[model samples]
Target chain A: MPKGVPERGSIPDDGLTTRQRRQQPVLAIHTGTGKGKSTAAFGMAMRAWNQGFDIGVFQFVKSAKWRVGEETALRALGDAHLASGIGGPVEWHKMGEGWSWIRKHGDDADHAEAAREGWAEIARRLASERHRFYLLDEFTYPLKWGWIEVSEVVEALRARPGNQHVVITGRDAPPELIAAADLVTEMTKIKHPMDAGRKGQRGIEW
Target chain B: MPKGVPERGSIPDDGLTTRQRRQQPVLAIHTGTGKGKSTAAFGMAMRAWNQGFDIGVFQFVKSAKWRVGEETALRALGDAHLASGIGGPVEWHKMGEGWSWIRKHGDDADHAEAAREGWAEIARRLASERHRFYLLDEFTYPLKWGWIEVSEVVEALRARPGNQHVVITGRDAPPELIAAADLVTEMTKIKHPMDAGRKGQRGIEW
Candidate 1:
């Protein structure tokens, strides 16, 4: 167990029984200036996928052109499940304005609209319980930039039905969103390769 | 890209060319009061596995009996790679004193000795470059607790030959170790399920 983490039995009473607590879904936030925020969320998604949790990943900042290693692996896992009926469904959606968006729309308004559309889709999924695990990668940026309302996002998450687990990853996550989350991890940066004049490498960064 | 991360072209010069910088190995430290430190390392291992980099994992705190989901997945990948010759070799070693060790040794001296042995084995591997990527999971505790000398570790890592990338995970990592590392990410806890009176659940923690 990690240091400073209280044992389950030792945790102070919150007026909830073990069964009641077990039934509660997690709203985890991964926000910080360091690396691994998104990677860590992807790791959890992998575990959830292993447990037959239908997973939905909505990317907010990353471009559609950049294919991350996790996406490739998880998509393959989802395909294998489709072929052999072993695991769960996995869907990935990229909401950022990449080169394609620039070529087509060439406006910031289009990017903002894309972000809003992504959140609406997620809201719909949450209402219908379409996915057991939802990863809102870099979703905090849109809220910070005022493209999405923090209140609406919080309300949707709080009212999200069933046992759906949601994970949000980004830097500078709003105080309201952090308050709404059950679990939040801030990745503090002590050092980075770029500090030593190195660029992000394939496999390590992607 | 993550907020505040310098783009490749914008990275400041550190007197090394791109090729020279790429050749240098990375010594990354993941530490702090939050979860996903180890999970993030496991994700990197997954990426390395995909790139066919020979990987070695040494767990210092977690027991051999505790089967983490990442271990299961990576081991499965390793097995598949071995069967198909698609990837590189993968080795995992647990050096912690589990239930059996407590039953037999039942002393701090034994635990300290085990930590020393684990470090010695890793040092030997570093010298020979047995693995391209080495994950020393939960290794910070030994240094913090004085079971292993931080200076010796720093020296070994500094002198470690080849382009071997090392990632160490645990909380309260020593300042000396952090200073020696090329990249350090501190996982700060903003909130947790345990804070909400929830225990570690399957497909989330393990």
Candidate 2:
């Protein structure tokens, strides 16, 4: 056997009878304080979709403020599969007289329930191999903050099919979540204008 | 303190206190089997130079076949700093001329040493905080094959001043490197046509 070549027994059935399986849909989580966690996943989703892959995204923490950017872009590809949890009927917070808005309609409990529903949908698609790329945007932070349980989330993900790649983004991700991942990134905060009370740029933030 | 406020005391009083630090340059690496690593890095270099950041690029593991398309595009931006490992010397492989086009030039030990000079120049700019962005192309695959020590690379990185953002891309990165990374990703190969005998695409692959 040549060096760096895998043994015969380990080959995946995807046509290469060698020990290598075609790369499974990766499971990744993006966490920490740096900007661009979700943006990075959005870039990957776009690239993967360009190469012919279906995608699903759920924005867990976002209420009405969550504009459908990634979803819109994915749909532009024309082969994408889309689903989301909208910010129910209430306004959670108001910035002046509608100059700004937050999830005022739903309380933490409502958000948690919406997130659970969203996760169930994501897990269902993963199990059936319905999509090549699945993104649970800001899914774990609510769970980490005690709005959702780790057990419920883990059970759903453990049953995910081998062919689906799931991407989660948030801050303060739990340890068990990191352990189960094939890839994880912690975006360390180095510097930002937010610390100086400067507001975020429109296109850059939100 | 509110939850998730970037832990205090993470920033140092070095020259990178503000985004205005002239000498603190961005560090980037493009490594992996897939094409576009160099192209992506070049895009960032151009973006930074256009924004008035002095840019330096260390071309490791590249051969004379590494043609720079769009010379006119680059010539329009006159202030960019450009350097290459090969000044004009053309080396042929013993197996044949055809292999030279496909083989990674830096994977070989002797050619890897050839890049040491270019990297040193990049290092000088990093230390002096002279440039705004330094792109180290194909840096880690050689490290993976033991052509370069990871610690030596880390030392060179630590020598860089504050507020520098480094992007390194490679397949099968070491755990130590992952731990040190602020952002990391694994480009799992799910459906590549190369497995079915399809050739690379121009403008996209090359």
Cα RMSD to the true fold for all candidates:
4.4, 12.0
lDDT per residue, candidate 1, B123-174, as tens digits?
9989999999999998999898999999999999999998899999999999
Model 2: per-residue lDDT, tens digit, A31-81?
765544565565444444434455565666554343333333233233212
lDDT tens readout by residue for model 2, B1-206: 01223344443455343334323333333333433344434444333443434444444544423323212123223311233221111121211112233445444446555545445555665677655445555566667877677777777776678545455555556656655543343332223334333232221122
Worst 10 residues of 1 chain A by lDDT: A98-107
Give the poorly placed runs of model 2, Cα more than 4 Å off.
A1-20, A23-25, A29-50, A57-110, A124-130, A169-206, B1-6, B10-109, B117-132, B137-206
lDDT of 1 at A167: 91
- Candidates' lDDT values, in order? 0.78, 0.46
Predicted complexes: DockQ each: 0.39, 0.05
Top candidate, metric TM-score = 1
Per-model TM values vs. the true structure? 0.85, 0.45
